[model samples]
Target: MQESISVCHNQYILKPQSIESEELENATFHAKQRAIEARQTISPWKKSHSLYETGGWKSLFENINQPLNLSTQSKEFQTRYNESANSLEQVVESAKLPLCPSGQPEIGNTVVFGVVGGTVEAPSIAYLTESQPVTEEILALSDSVKPTEIFRIASSCQADACRHFDGANCRLAVRIVQQLPTVVETLPACQIRSSCRWWQQEGKAACYRCPQMVTDNGYSSKILQEVGDPYSK
Candidate 1:
C-alpha cells in the first residue's frame, strides 16, 4: 500500500509536466505562456507531506549528538543539517499566497507546481523532489499537528460540489487528511461525497491550492491532482 501511494504520488506529480508539454506542443499560446510562468516557480520540496519537519529529526540529531556518545564530536554536523532542513520546511510551508494578489482566501488559494523524483519540470512548486520526504522530525510534526479550519473552509467554499449532500456532510472520503489544531478527528461524515468536484473531478486527490495547506505543511502532488488538470478544467 505504501509503495502504491508513492507510485500514485509519482504519477500525479508527473501529470502536470505532461500537460505543460502538451500545451507547448499544441501551441496554445495562453497555456504555453502560463506554463512558462508557472515553471519558473516550481520547487521539489514544496509539496510533499512526507518531507516536513516539526520535532522528530530534531530529537534524533540531538540524541546522536548527546555528550555521552563517543561519536558526538563528529555528529555535530547532523544537527546543523537537521536545523537547515527544518528551516527550509518552514519557509516552504508558511508562505501566504495571494488569491487575487491581494492576499485573501475569499478568492481562493494559488497553487505552484513542483517536481518530485526526477529532472522533470513542473508548472508550480507544489510537489516534492527526488530526495525529499519527511524525516523523523517531520513525521513527529505531523503527529503533533491538527486539522485546520480550511478543511471546513474549503468544504464551505465549494459547498455546492461537495458530496456530503444531506446539506452539510463532507461525505466524499471517509478520511480527509488535514492538519487541524487539535487531535486527529474524523470530521463529520461527508454527506456530499459523490457530488464533490474534488471527488468527481480529481478522484481520491487532495486539494493543494487550499489555504490550509499553503499555511501549513507545503503542497504535494496528491493535493494538486484533486484540483484537476488545467487543460481539462
Candidate 2:
C-alpha cells in the first residue's frame, strides 16, 4: 500500500508507514522549498530581455558611474560612454512587464486582441499585434460593437485597479480555477504566456480556461458571465 500527498495540481505517492517514505516526503518538501527560493531570487526584470542582459537598477548605476582611465579619456570616448549609458537606461525603462489580458490596458504599445473560435475539440485564434493594424473604420465601429462579439481584448494587466487583487495575490484567479470547468489538461500554446499576468499568477490552471474566456456583454453562459466580470459581486 502507498500514501499520496497533493501539491497544488500534482500528487506524489509514498510507501505506506515506512521510514524511507517519511524521509522521502521530507526531502521532497525541502526540494520544493529550495526551488521556490531559487525562483524568487531571480528578478522578474531579467526575463524581459531576450539576450539576458543585466539591465536592472544596480546595473544602471554602474553604467553611469564606471571609473574612466585618464590616459584613454578623450572627447570621443566620453561621448560614446554617455551614449552607451543612455541606451542602457532606455532598455531598462522600456522593458514591458507582463500584463493580465482580462485586466485594464496600461500601455499603448500594441493591441493583441483576438476572437476565440473552433470547437471543444480544437480552438482557433490569432493575436493581433502592432504589425496588423485595425483600420480607423473598425476602430470607430468598435465603440458600438461589443468586444466579445468580435474579439477578446488582450490588453495590459492593471493589478492596482483589479477587484481580485488583495494587495498581494489575485483572488479572481483563484475564483476562476474553482468556478470554470477545465477544458484542457495541459497548457495551451500561448504567445503572451511569458508576459501574461494570469499565467504568472495562477500557472497552467488559468490557461485551461483562458482560450474560451469572453468579456463581451450579454453572455448566455452563466459561468462565462461570472468569470468574465471580475468586478461582479
TM for every model, in the order presented, reads 0.18, 0.46
Q: Evaluated with lDDT, which candidate comes out highest?
A: 2
**RMSD values, in order shown:** 18.8, 21.0
List residue ranges in candidate 2 displaced over 4 A.
1-97, 103-107, 118-144, 228-233
What digit string (tens of lDDT, one per residue) describes model 2 on residues 140-166? Answer: 333333323334445444333345566
Candidate 1, residue 199: lDDT: 45
Candidate 1 scores a C-alpha RMSD against the true structure in Å of 18.8
The clash number for model 1 is: 40
Clashes of each: 40, 1
Scanning candidate 2 in windows of ten residues, the lowest lDDT window is 48-57
Q: Which candidate ranks first by TM-score, i.e. highest?
A: 2
Tens digits of per-residue lDDT, candidate 1, 1-233, equal: 00111133233222222123222213223223433333454546443221112212223333442222223422463344445554665434423311111011111221212211122222222122121121232222222231110112121122222122223323222123332111112221222334334444334343432211221222334443332111112
Displacement of the residue 82 alpha carbon in candidate 2, Å: 31
